[model samples]
Target: MAINIRNAVIQNVTGNSREELEDTIVDAVQSGEELMLPGLGVLFEIIWQNASENDKKEMLQRLAGGLAK
Candidate 1:
């Protein structure tokens, strides 16, 4: 059987409130654990899917700027 980790992560956080989600993200980043990367990627994918073109461009620009540093 194939495991869909992205879907699993999404399901794990399903119905999370904005504050709860923010807390989860903050905790994950503060921990600096590689294990949390997949979950963060999944969250970013969701945001990318819902973002407007302008928002997407801004995100890309920010990411690029951060990477440049």
Candidate 2:
């Protein structure tokens, strides 16, 4: 059976508070585990979908700057 990872990630964090979500993201990044990437991608997808054009531009700029470093 193929599991929908995005849906599973969303469901896992459905009721998380802002701080809790922040902790989750921080922990995932700090761990440097490859398995955490799909969940992070799902979180980014949600943020990207809801973000305004200006927010998206800022994110893109930051991403580009980070990549350049």
Candidate 3:
């Protein structure tokens, strides 16, 4: 299943500014706010949408290292 970026982005409640909305996403990342994807497919899509290839690779590496704990 595909997560509609249009819907995901615009369907949310109104906000004051773009900076404020982006800050919310940043906070979600830092706070490990798990997304409620329709399925794992949508989840992976969202991950790729947010991260470039290198970013995903680096994040995966760090995630692996963290998991070693």
Candidate 4:
């Protein structure tokens, strides 16, 4: 038998685009899921590779501060 139409849930709408994806990602980030960190870390690593020595030092300092907690 055919099923009756009922309330449905939409995960991601077709009208939703990359901007929506970014907003979802940002919301997930604020919710404290570390699953997003690896991508961000890779980006940081790429930038670090071309950064100056002083920049690396400053980056290390910031990383240390984040690690302390």
Best by lDDT: 2
Candidate 2 per-residue lDDT over residues 1-69, each given as its tens digit: 999999999999999999999999999999999999999999999999999999999999999999999
Which consecutive 10 residues in model 2 have the weakest lDDT in total?
5-14
**Worst 10-residue stretch by lDDT in candidate 4?**
4-13
* Residue 47 in model 3: lDDT: 71
Q: What is the C-alpha RMSD of each candidate to the true structure, in Å?
A: 1.1, 0.4, 5.9, 11.8
Model 4, runs deviating above 4 Å: 1-28
Candidate 1 per-residue lDDT, tens place, 12-63, comes to: 8899999999999999999999999999999999999999999999999999
Candidate 3 Cα lDDT to native: 0.62
- Candidate 4, residues 1-69, lDDT tens digits: the string is 663222111223235676875675577679777865654454455578899999999989998999998
lDDT against true structure, model 2: 0.99
Off by over 4 Å in 3: 1-10, 13-45
Quantify all predictions' global Cα lDDT against the true fold: 0.95, 0.99, 0.62, 0.61
Clashes of each: 0, 0, 0, 0
Q: Compute each candidate's TM-score over C-alphas.
A: 0.91, 0.98, 0.38, 0.47
Arrange candidates, best TM-score first.
2, 1, 4, 3
6 in model 1: Cα distance from truth in Å?
1.1
Among these predicted structures, which one has the highest TM-score?
2
> What tens-digit string does per-residue lDDT give for candidate 3 at 10-59?
44624548687567555666766456333233435557789988999998
lDDT at position 46, candidate 1: 94
TM-score of 1: 0.91
State the RMSD for candidate 4: 11.8
